[model samples]
Target: MPEYRRSLDIYQGYNYKKDKQTPVGYLTKIKVAGTDLTVDQTCKDPTNPTTDLKCVAVLSGALWETGVTDAVYLSGQVSAPNRQTLASLIINSLTSVEVVYQFAVYDYDPVAKKYYLAFHANQTDMNGLLEKRGEDLNVSVADDASTEVQSPINYSFQIGIKPQPSAQTLHIATADQKNVVKSWGLALG
Candidate 1:
């Protein structure tokens, strides 16, 4: 089998927000870039061997917001620094987003090292925080003797998010000055 080089573009976009905030919330949006992976095809002896092709790609980003509420204390203690104050302040949290891509191999080309991508998914139509990864391109098969065959392999994408520093802010801090404006917000509740 011959070596092959291919380029594929995958675009993904999703909304992530906190379920609810104790006192404040931030507006955020996250855009994820595309990813590329290599695929190989091999055969043993004169017969085509049973083979499997698996790939896993992970994408992550942090969402931040400014001017969140924080904890405050009253003027009464002189040494107790960790005491609960009667005042409130602004705070922020980090939200990490993760996505994965999975596909199963079904066939291959002998002349060119290209594998077929085939994966099964449920056919449902619903709109409510759905993780969508754009379709993946197929591997090309070409030889010096014949024209190249454009075989589009199929795959599926999965996405999720995890909230970091689950602290409630009482005050709205400066996003530009504090760099909180660069982060994505989880929810507005």
Candidate 2:
């Protein structure tokens, strides 16, 4: 069996404005391709810091302050077969977002590796202006292949509720809660 490993890429200390109409901090934004897609937004305190000042163990302590917070946007493209479905996707607000996805298409040559965009359902909330609306485009992936994946696959993620901090991580696994939760690389023990 190929050993499966997961890693994260983080960009630290991006700034944000608290008083904006959209409280979610948007550090940077990037446009994806000929189609409409974008990334990089805001982050918020998911929960109270684990420990107090005496021995603070907050995962995102620095950002917990009520004022300004940092944000980071994800960048990638979306690909789908003729069909489009609106799906609720959960991404790591702090970098440990997990989901089950399928490969939109199979590779023609096993010797060579290629990446393609996966399609996902778009909910009714889509503001009509999807390009700048901050909606994520789901990328379809195969569960069987993903379960046995040993390396990171290039995927187009749906725009998360907020921009994930650099400290956050991404996980892809089978949709089954058991497999999805268990197969994650950055799970909290």
Candidate 3:
């Protein structure tokens, strides 16, 4: 059993106008606000880092398929403010923006006392609106007062991802964090 850190990296690219740049390469800290529980792993435990994950590392997939789409699940526990922000982030990036959404699930290296990314992904064939969080609906006829207690929102969105070789490797391969841009966009800070 080892501690893990899962993060979502949204590609920084030109704005909808394609005139100026937007926030470039922001690694979104994926977390469920107000809830203290750790989220579950969505992708498979990455194979031997020392062996697998490099270019041409694997032999084949089932039949003619060389790779498979890894589905990443979001917990329904995400707060309302977060969901609204996520929705805004997903807008327009699906096509013209060419925003590449990536995910990093890190394997904690105890000896180093730090987290190193293991798995990665980028945006592919999917609609951003599809990543919709649950919305409230009014119902006239509801359950009786004696019915079971109210269940917390369990709605979630799924991001289908393919392995991000470059980002994943660079995460550990990089000698220092200086080259890695701390923040981006108009600020560039």
Candidate 2 ranges beyond 4 A from true positions: 1-69, 81-83, 86-189
How close is every model to the real structure, measured as TM-score?
A: 0.15, 0.16, 0.26
- Which prediction has the highest TM-score against the true structure? 3
Per-residue alpha-carbon lDDT of candidate 1 for residues 1-189, written as tens digits (9 for 90 to 100): 211112221211111112211111111112212211232211121112243222222111112122222111101110111111101000112131221122111223334343222111111111112122353211111112111211222222222322223332221122212211212223455
Clashes of each: 29, 25, 0
lDDT-based ranking, best first? Answer: 3, 2, 1
lDDT of 2 at 55: 8
Runs with alpha carbons beyond 4 Å of true place in candidate 1: 1-8, 11-55, 58-154, 166-181, 184-189
Which model, 1 or 3, shows the larger TM-score?
A: 3
Clashes of 2: 25
RMSD of 1: 25.8
Where's the lowest-lDDT run of ten residues in candidate 2? Answer: 55-64
Worst 10 residues of 1 by lDDT: 70-79
Q: Which stretches of candidate 3 lie over 4 Å from their true place?
A: 1-66, 70-79, 85-99, 121-189
Per-residue CA lDDT of model 3 for 1-189, tens digit only, reads 212123332111101122222211212233221121223212122222222221100101111011222223321222234334445444424332212332333334445444344333322212111222344211011112211112322223323222222222112212112123111112112
What value of lDDT does candidate 1 attain over all alpha carbons?
Answer: 0.19
TM-score of 3: 0.26
Highest lDDT, which number? Answer: 3
Tens digit of per-residue lDDT, candidate 2, span 82-105: 112112122222222322121111
